[model samples]
Target: MSSNDSDSWGAVASSYVQVERLTTPPCQTLVNRVSLLLPLNVPNTIAFDNGCGTGVLSAVLRQQYPRLPLLATDASHGMVNILRRRIEHRKWDEVRTRVVDSRNLEGIQDGSFTHVFSTFMVCLAPEPDKIVGEMQRVMKPGGVLGLAVWGDPQFGPFSTPWEKACRRLVPDYEAPMVMDAKWTFAASVEAGLVEAGFKDVVVWEEDVPWRWDDVEAVSKYYLEGNNPGNVGMIDAFKARGGDVEEVRPIFEGIIKEDCGQKDGSIELHAPATLATARK
Candidate 1:
């Protein structure tokens, strides 16, 4: 794939605007990560959530820390609108929504926040190092920065099959911007924190098992969920003499077989690494 093909992620933001992850109630994974790092009760500090997709995590954080000021941002106007609507109807207070790029929080002031958070976004950033620097810059010296990113693909049940299909479609396709769990082990997070003048970094992880009542349903949802990103992927498949429409059913069937269980539930592990560092 050419370098230009990589810039097609805007579709992801647009397509996932009304997705289930944001509309559903808080999940165990969300609760556990925040519970682990946050104090017994919510604090009265200013907080920021980068890539606040549909404001799911941001909503949960606001609930957990009602006394804190929250700023939720995304690179998508659609997502920002959805978040604003959701919050307005619920009357959540002191929470601002904006279409701010994570790579540089220029509109946000330096040392102005007591907490910073991001989920499943840092890895997708074009410049992760710059994003970390921005996070550090916007946080106070003793502030806590909490973030979560993709773990091992083998354990990320939803992503593994999707990634496999993408690879099969474009063998040479390499994701230069995607961050993986290995980044933490290789000091990518630690080094970035240090370079950004962060301190006392602590990282932890947990696996969230996502279960669907049927393999077919899970596979179908997965395909439908990620169909927006398939523009480039489908183009790659066609360029390789692959009939994407014809192959989609086969790919979906393969995913079902790969994830099926005898008890009528298809299970996949969605693991996330949680990290906290001080600025």
Candidate 2:
């Protein structure tokens, strides 16, 4: 998340698809927050879901506003494929999929969408300012650009253990995280939006729900599990010449020890920011 490059985001997003259960709440909530700024039921209210990893926002919009058309996009082919499969499974005829890097949405023409929303991706972009500019270029004159980022990311209890585990597996390895401190403040987000030529910018905080009902599945995904979209942890381990399966149990132990809760469930505090601006 620190690097302002597509590959870093791809890796981070690739892992996100594997953990959709805990992420769905925030994605849906962000959509709800952004809805207040932009009208969705109008016939001309076409939407763009930028950086739409696995099409979570698309699914939310489709379910809520059945008649609204959506263009869902992500830089990762694997993620787009997953979204394609979801579209196929859900029979969402109003939604289309594209594999486009958000920083350069060259495939799309100017003023193409009335509403553009990206959840959980703006801060991690290598060229966040450029992406905002591209958003401005693609949105209509009175269009709304709504996005969400972790405004002061709160790492889970297992974050320290996970970092230490990475060190144990990969010597002298500095752990790469998806939350960039630069875009973690609401004021920073508002300033960036205003600088990008967006007016009436609004930034507000929201608490994203982070909970895991099953620790075993969480542990498996944390390491080398069956998830093909597991480049975040698995690739980090592999790129460092370490075996992820060997350390799976260690993470499981750590999660159960630190993240375990009294109600027989695990939870983490997640604070986020939702930003909306008019282009």
Candidate 3:
């Protein structure tokens, strides 16, 4: 990812963390499953949480393995600040936060981590292979690496509407390209891990549901919030001579109508893929 992309995420660290906490079941699932898969009680175990936005997975991992050393890193300095604050508030002395790109984990020695994990990070990379290579490089032989990513956005509840809205508004717009085709499916993810020299790879897909009590809340997250994806959509809309203020209502209306509103709330099922492998 570019510095600008990291900066965009940094700008919305607070809101992004809030919304992700409520909406990202796949992330929680990755943490739970990886905890079960890895030998947390192993002596001298150290873990890396790459792209550790706001330290959500790091916090959970700390609770799971109180004595385990945790290093959380992100490209966004703003995200690292939130993570540092979280660590300070919780007094997790074993947990450390750093601002670093997942693609090039500078100053981190090879095979230094016994367990490496990332959630919703690899897919966002401009080059998923570089991130995977770094993850594999840092992981000790026989160590496990786990990651979660969005499945096909066409089948996703929240992403599909926005995708459709953008296409409708912008005549020449195309959905953002996937960093790796394998990132969108469980089997492909497994194959990619194997290709990266990981063994005993396991992958699965799930539909995680997110609920919002108000349409405006959804609008605020996608529009008002400093979400990089939405910001790009707004840019595309303007590039096509569409006014953001005018297009937002139309976009919200499409989302409300298509995303299945019930009892004054919107329920969205986000299709996600989770994968783990031993290096």
The lDDT leader among the candidates is: 3
lDDT of 2 by residue, 25-70 (tens): 7777767766777778988888999888777778888999988999
RMSD of 3: 2.3
How many clashes does each candidate structure show, in the order listed? 0, 3, 0
Best by TM-score: 3
Give the higher-lDDT candidate: 2 or 3.
Answer: 3
Model 1: per-residue lDDT, tens digit, 97-188?
A: 88777776767898888778777666645677777778888887777877766554233354456546656666654322234444433256
Q: Which stretches of candidate 2 lie over 4 Å from their true place?
A: 1-18, 152-158, 164-177, 225-254
Stretches of candidate 3 exceeding 4 Å from the true structure: 22-24, 153-155, 163-174, 178-180
Return the TM-score for candidate 3, rounded to 2 decimals.
0.90
Candidate lDDT scores, in order, read 0.63, 0.73, 0.78
* Candidate 3 residue pairs in backbone clash: none
| Deviation of model 2 at 263, angstroms | 4.8
Better of 1 and 2 by lDDT: 2
User: Ten consecutive residues with minimal summed lDDT in candidate 3?
Assistant: 153-162
Per-model TM-score on C-alpha atoms: 0.77, 0.79, 0.90
lDDT tens digits, residues 33-83, model 3? Answer: 776887866788899999988887887788778888999999999889998
The lDDT, on a scale of 0 to 1, for candidate 3 is: 0.78
